[model samples]
Target chain A: NAGVIQTPRHKVTGKGQEATLWCEPISGHSAVFWYRQTIVQGLEFLTYFRNQAPIDDSGMPKERFSAQMPNQSHSTLKIQSTQPQDSAVYLCASTISAEQFFGPGTRLTVL
Target chain B: AQSVTQPDARVTVSEGASLQLRCKYSYSGTPYLFWYVQYQRQGLQLLLKYYSGDPVVQGVNGFEAEFSKSDSSFHLRKASVHWSDSAVYFCAASRTGGYKVVFGSGTRLLVSP
Candidate 1:
């Protein structure tokens, strides 16, 4: 099981540009989660999906951050008009039950 | 609100020596505790989890954690440390059947030869 797969291990975008991170979860896993990691904030929950539907997104920034799970296998996090503060490692995790298996994460850099 | 605290920002240990990392949690309900490790440049990986029954739970790679409800603590330990064990350890907690998993500020472990 490839665990979870995240695209573009690294990404660089100018301020006000758009950045979209991709994640492909393990097969048959019904739950997917997204988190942002930084030196100051540690791991911050962004959003989550259960069975291809968004369950909770209380941690999302609400203005520019959005997430979607179009199918059981994949999900995406899109940031519109990215700012410098958006730079961080975006991590994706998938779980069949409670134990979450994480992907290598995408490092997003907004300059 | 739920929260977790990892008091130590960094810990250094000699190779083959025993190791321990401290964690404290705050929650009113029955807690679901977990310990996860992050290798450099990698995402976090689960080490162990404690839900009920025995307070002492074993994990992969010779890691174990003991949960103390009285103290609200779940600390990770290893009998013998290896260089590969150098990484950041994170303590997390959640309400039973809840989707929100709160994480603590990680403790960075460094194993020296």
Candidate 2:
């Protein structure tokens, strides 16, 4: 399997701009997850979907952060009015069982 | 609430030395634990996982972890280390059959030759 794929390995956005990150899960995987990593905050769970449905998003910032999985293969995480605090590595993972396979992640740099 | 904790932010070891990275979890139910390794600028790679079987689970590159329900701990161990083993390690936990996962602050391992 080619494993999970994430688009735009790196992204630069000015403050107040919008940014979208994409993830393509492994074939036939039923669960997709999103996480954010920053040196100050460590790792934070943004949200997750099961069978293309959002299951949990308690970790998301709510105001400007949102995620969607419209189909089985792909999921998108969008940040509107992005801030400098949003600068971090956004990770996407896919799984059918306990273990998840992760994508290389998109490094979002907001200036 | 569920959470994971890795007390060590960074660890350094000489090549060929043994290594152990600590992890602790706070969960009410039986949780599935996992250890993942991340090379610089790379994705997280599963080093090992513990579901319901034996307490000790083996993973890639001579990596292994032991789970202790009483201690609420799942610590990773390696018999001997190499420079290639230098990476950030994360400990994660999830409720059984649950979708949400909790990750610990990664432990950065620096293996010196």
Candidate 2, residue A7: CA error in Å?
A: 0.4
* DockQ score for candidate 2: 0.80
What interface RMSD do all candidates show, one decimal each?
A: 1.2, 1.0
* Range of the 10 consecutive residues with the lowest summed lDDT in candidate 2 chain B: B94-103
Model 1 Cα lDDT, one tens digit per residue, B1-113: 68999999999999999999999999987689999999999999999999899999999999999999889999999999999999999999988877568899999999999
Quantify all predictions' global Cα lDDT against the true fold: 0.94, 0.94
DockQ per candidate, 2 decimals = 0.68, 0.80
Model 2, span A1-111: residue lDDT tens: 899999999999999999999999999999999999988987788899999989989899979999999899799999999999999999999999878999999999999
lDDT of 1 by residue, A22-85 (tens): 9999999999999999999989999999999999998899899999999997999999999999
Which docking class does model 1 fall in?
medium
Q: Which pairs of residues collide in model 2?
A: none
Model 2 TM-score relative to the real fold? 0.96
